[model samples]
Target: MQWPDLFDDDNVDDDDLSEMTRKYLPDTVVWTTDWTTGSLIEQLERNVFNVDPPFQRRSAWSDTKASLYIESLLLGCPVPPVTLAELPAQGSEGNFQYVVIDGKQRLTTLKRFALDGELKLTGLKVLRDLNGRSYSEVEQEPEFRRFANLPVRTVVLRNWKKDEVLQFVFHRLNTQTTPLSTHELRRALLAGGFTDYLDRESASSEGLQRILGISEPDYRLRDAELLLRAIAFVRYSNRYKGNLKQFLDTITRSANRSWSEPFARELDEVVGSINSAISAVYDIFDKGAFQRIDDEGQPSGRFNRAVFDILVMTFQNETIRRAATADPQAVRSAFTVVNRNPDFKRFISGTTKTPEAVNGRLRIWWKQLSSALELPYESFEQVQTW
Candidate 1:
């Protein structure tokens, strides 16, 4: 029993990826770096510095987040350097202005307290003296001018000027420290309809929760990342190059551009496949599988990412899909074989990121299920039965 998949994704060579990724990289200009707090307030007020620029993620700082940075300032601790870019002046658009390429959270914190004086500072671990004081009131205090004059190092890049460059730099900078969650990074770099679809679908998914038995979404977007993993490899397996993170980024980035009715339909098809697979697995497993321990066969609380990959890959295969419709128990039995196979356990526990690992595990799982179901297909790997 063989069915043609939607795409052939068995090979993602370097030559294919090189040309695709190069389109996103921008030409760089000579960068000038400077550490300045001199007239920084003037710069904010002059329409010279734009904190919330287009295509940037929303400034997600709560007052607590804001206070931590301001606290660092008041206590004279050096925070991370802010990265800024100088955009060349557009004649009709406006004067040349600097955009906060990185450090939007910190810069926005500055705007909230130091400039607008809107938020009163609180929870100061070091500067307990200035607790519960806004910058306006604090500036009047004798020792407060020192806090106001504290220099914030800004790394300004001159004419490193392309929107692609800005997007790339912004992605890199934020990914370095206190790194952006997978969804947050995707939303920032690839804001548009398709990501919006992924969000709504991920949130509303009863199937995802039931299969994994998760009560809520992972704050780090691990669940969403796995969902994305299934969607990507199923559709673009051969299209994947070395970096899985960038591969996911590319999927969202391309979706941001090619959005329309047909694209919506395309998304619908993928969602349909994923949801149907989840429902079938639940129908077969009785109590939603994959939590049971290997060898001992006792259920565990923690969710394993590698096992989720195996199950999703199983559903993606045509033979298992047809076989599961007949007896989901047989599919469960195949999972038992997976646990029993020593090499399968090590492979699932190993570096699941590599293409070889990913494809190899899937092939191994398919071999197990194929033998258990006695389904014959051309080119099925000859399995050494456990």
Candidate 2:
């Protein structure tokens, strides 16, 4: 939240520093590009410099989307421009940080296409000519295949000042055209190191969802941001605060390496942890509060907010301490004690617990569970809950 020095020579002039800011473009502007200039990589690397802006989540486009963008660029397709916003300098990392104000999905798609080259596109190509005619007129068109090898058109706003960037981020991210959630922004920005490692290990949402048993994939579940937030909160055990991406990168890098694993193995463990915690949340925390049952056999008025906090605390402790060990029995027994604990209802709701009280409970829970589960975490003590 650092503001640039308006009095600095670079930002203000003696004659016009006092001039009132005015806009002719409603305080926001957007542009387009083809991905041919290799700008996708440039922008992504520029994003690396924008460490604070890591509030945007990690890369989430599927391999197919990447391939499609590549195909579009190669075929001279008219793709939409990438969006940018100029925001004030927050720090050295943000001297010229530009938020991708909009078009993150498209940009991500293009980057993955260039880096991985493993995307699968639907049967469509970008070779439709004027008069709305496709290349259908040419039989066995060799040109279409040739076009598929090219890059995309890229549109970008060059160096913009910070206020304009903030205004742009606010507008595009808040709009209905394809809103980016706080959680998704967390994914884009906060994702690196352990989170990125976790993402790399289990990139597919279907795989993670299948393991968690949360629900079948649908519109709500399809949101990459929701999945990222769930993963990050469970993996790191932190609240979904602003600028989470940057925070995670810094913390996770300093965190114990023992907690991370290859994408497949860690993914399995994360899925298990989230599923168990989520179930515990509903069964012991949410459903515990209600006597009313709907005709569908679901609780009508159950409040499960308490369990969510408990789970967050429990998860967060593990992240800080690297509680997951190499031993399998230890992990199982640790969580089993969590399953048997009975005070989550009072704990998370503040009915009988303050933040201090909650940490005490978690300490006891982890100690007994780790011992019961034979986990390596028995040696790691718990920290304060949020």
Candidate 3:
């Protein structure tokens, strides 16, 4: 029986809305203090502060923006307070006293300018005289002295029990500034055992990185997000509705909070399956794996997330993996043929986050690849789908 294609839009349903509306009151104590840039830099130098927390995004401010911020500090302009979360002291052996929950970019700019000597002031409208001058070159100048002595407000949160509250605070704080990516927000809100696991696996998996075509780690966490997509689909496809973000968010939060020995074992198995699947696909397609094939029957362009999800899941079956391994050409031909299909193309391209498109593409690819490999289509049919 042919599975029905239920076309749907990216509308939020009641369950998702409820999830969004849910609220919690965190048991946190907050206090504010004024610290000079010199003091802050000293603390940073002493490694008393963790600027690169797992939840914080990488430094994203351009040189010009960072210079402007430095100029503002020199001019005594009012700047937003930096928010930090205090790390619990563990027998006087803790490395960091606090983690920067907000203002990482600002702190990073400071470190780059004063400590690293990397940032030369440029595009400074107010302090045009400081342009082309490194911090070391102008440290004796009055402007530099004033900038170092400027008092910046710092807000500190301590005794927070729930990480979710910290996530909420980070989310609320960043809504006014440069918007964060979903994966960035996820990392901030869901930094726990499962997310740590995702990070470790994504970083160590050479085959997965080859397929992703990234040598260095993605600062934006897009690579981790892709792995999460594959994991979610492979493990919880039946639970996925039409909302991809909510599905991923819920699963991530749940997995992090409810992590146990059994769950860890299951994840270990899933990671192995993902690795096996990646190996099988890479054997057949090499670096071109998970990319869309162009009209010339050549794989081209960026890696396709939808294609990655389905292929990784399909190849998880040992039978499919062994068949593809034994007949790489036939598997490659099946991939090209399926990519040429109009319906399959649409299923992978526009509006692919919908349940209809996800399920449709998986079904189509599984059917085609199974037939080409001379395997029973019923094997894929028996697998769960939403």
Q: What is the TM-score of each candidate against the true structure?
A: 0.63, 0.40, 0.67
> What C-alpha lDDT do the candidate models reach, one value each?
0.62, 0.42, 0.76
Per-residue lDDT for 213-298 in model 1, tens only?
55654433434655677677667667776566667778877877888999888777776777766676667665535433456754
- Show pairs that collide, candidate 3: none
Residue 365 in candidate 2 has what lDDT?
59
1-386: candidate 2 lDDT, tens digit per residue:
11121101111121221221233233344455455435455656556323223332444455445556545655556666555544456786656555554566666554444333333344344533311223232224564444544455434454443232333343444554433333333333334554454444334444334322334332212234334444554555443333333333344444324445565476566555554444433333333321222344343343232233344445444442243333434544444444345554234333322344445455655676556545555344433322
Segments of candidate 3 deviating more than 4 angstroms? 1-51, 55-103, 111-141, 149-180, 382-386
Candidate 3 lDDT at 386 equals 22
Winner by TM-score: 3
Residue 23's C-alpha lDDT in candidate 1? 63
Residue 73 Cα positional deviation in candidate 1, in Å, after optimal superposition: 2.3
| Superior candidate under TM-score, 1 versus 2 | 1
Q: Return the candidate ranking by lDDT, descending.
A: 3, 1, 2
